[model samples]
Target: MFSDFIELIGAFVLVLAILQISSDRLFFSVKVYALQSFFVALSIFVIGLYSSSNDLYISAFLTLLIKVIIIPFTLFEAIKEMKIKREIETYINITNSLMIISSIIIISFILTRYIDLGGEIISKKIFPISLSIIFVGAFIMVSRKKPITQLIGFLTLENGIMLAATSVTYGMPLIVEIGIFFDVIVGATMATIIIHHINETVDDIDERTVENFEE
Candidate 1:
C-alpha cells in the first residue's frame, strides 16, 4: 500500500517534468517544477513513514522547505524583477522536443530492465520514471534558449537525482542531504545573480546574447 503511494508520487513527478518541457512559458514551467518538487518531497515523506526513519522525515521536510518553497519563491521574485515571460526560442521546436522526450522515456524503461539493483523496493517500482526525469531535465536545458529556463531544467535534474537516490538506497544520510540542500541554495543564488548581470549587459537573458556580447 505504501509502496503504491510512493510509486504514484514518482509518476506524478515524471509527468510534471513532461509538462514543463511541453510548455514554453517560463512562469508556467516554474509552477510545474514546483508541483514536481512537491511530489518528490511527498515521496520522501511517504517512504519515511513506511520505514519509520527519522532521518528520511527530516530530509523530506528540508526538501519541501527548500525545493518547493524557497527555490520557487526565489525564482518567482527573479522573474518579476527581470520582467520576462515566455522563452524566446528553442533549439528544437515543441513537436520535435516532445518526440525526443517520448523516446527518452521509452529508452529509460528499457534500460531499467537490464540494470541490476538488488532488492530495493523503490528501485523495482519507479526507477525508470526517475531516470526519465533526469534525461528530460537535461534535454530541457540544452534545447531552451533562456538562462532562467535552463535554471529550471537544472533544478528538475536535481529532483531526478534525488528520486533516483531514494529509489536505489532509500535516500542518503541526513548530513549529506543537508549539505546538498545548502549547495542547491547557494548554486541557485549564484545562478540568479549571474542571470541578472547577463540581462543587464545584453538586455536579454538568452545565452547566445551573452556569448555574442563577449565577442
Candidate 2:
C-alpha cells in the first residue's frame, strides 16, 4: 500500500514539474519546479524507508542536495543576477506549449505500458514512471527559453534517472551513489557560475542569443 502511494505521489510530481514548464511566468515556474522537487524527494525518501536499504537513504540525500537545494538556489541566483523579472517569453506560443505537455503525458502512459520487468514486482512498477518523467524533463528543456528553466528541466531529468535506478534495483552501493551525487553537486555549482558569467558578458538570459554577440 505504501509503495503504491509513493508511486502515485511520484507521478504527481512529474505532472507538477511539467505544469511548471508550461507556465508563462519564469518565477512561478521556478517556484513550481522547486515544489515538484520537494515532492519527488519526499516520495523517494519514503520508499527508501519502506525498503530498509541504506543506498536509498543516499539517494534521498542526493535528491535533497540536487533537487531541493542546489537546483533552486542556482535558479534563484541566476534570475536575480540576470534581472529577469519579466514573464517568460516562450519559444513557442502558450497554447502550443500546453498541447506539447499534454502530448508528453499521453505518450508516457503508452510507452510505460510495455516495460519488460521479467516478472519482478519492483521492476514492473517504477521504471515506467521514471522513464516518463525523464522524457518530460527533456521536453521541457527543449521547449523553454530561459536558461534557468533549462537547468530546472535538466535537474528534473537527473531526478528521473535517479528514481529509475532506485526503483529498479531497490538500492545500489552507498559509496558509488555518494560519489555520483558529489559530482552532480560540484557540477551544478560550476554551471551556476558559468551561467552567471554568460549573462553578464552577453547581456541576455536566452542561450540562443549567444549567436548575436557583437564583434
Candidate 3:
C-alpha cells in the first residue's frame, strides 16, 4: 500500500513536469514546479516512514523547507521585482513539445527495462518515472527562452535526481543530503541575483536577447 502511494506521487510529479513544459506563462511554470516539489517531499517522507530511516525523514524535511517553500518564494519575489512579462517564449510549438514529452516517457520505460536494480518492485517502477522527469526537465530548459523558465527546469531536474536517489538507495546519508540542499539553495540564490542584474541592464529576461548582446 505504501509503495502504491509512492508510485502515485511519482506519477503526479511526472504530470506536473509535463505541465511545466506545456505552460506558456512563467508564473504558472514556477507554481507547477512548486507543486511538484511538494509531492516529491511527500513521497520522500512516505519512504522514510516505511523504511524507518531517520535520514530520509530529515531529507524530506529539508526538501519541504527549501524546495517547496524557500525556492519558490525567492523566485516569485525575483519575478515581481524584475517586472518582466509573464508570457514565456519557446523554441518549440506546444504540439511538438507534448509529442516529445510522450516520446520521452515511452523511451524511459524501455530503457529502464533492461537495467535491473535489485528485486524491489517499487524501485523498478519509480526508476523510469524519475528518468522521464529528468528528461522532460532538460527539454524544458532547452526549449524555453526565458531565464526564469530555465531556472524552473533546473529545479525540476534536481527534483528528479532527488527522487532517483530515494528510489534507488532508499536515501543517502543525512550529511550528504544536507549538503545537496545547501548547494541548491546557494545556486538558486546566485541565479536569482544574476537574473536581477540581467534585468537591470538588458531590461528583458529572454535568453535570446542576452545571446544577441553577446554577439
Rank order (by TM-score, best first): 3, 1, 2
Model 1 worst lDDT window (10 residues): 204-213
Residue lDDT tens for model 2, 1-215 = 87678678767777786676667776777777777777766766886888777667767877777768777777777777677655565567777877877787778778878766675456455776777778878877777665666776787787787777666776567787787778877777787787777776775444423234434
What stretches of model 2 exceed 4 Å from their correct place? 123-125, 204-215
Query: Per-prediction TM-score, please?
Result: 0.93, 0.85, 0.94
| Position 175, candidate 1: lDDT | 87
Off by over 4 Å in 3: 119-121, 204-208
Clashing pairs in 1: none
Candidate 3: what lDDT? 0.85
Report the alpha-carbon TM-score of model 2 versus the true structure. Answer: 0.85
Candidate achieving higher lDDT, 1 or 2: 1
Name the regions of candidate 1 deviating beyond 4 angstroms.
85-88, 204-215
Clashing residue pairs, candidate 2? Answer: none
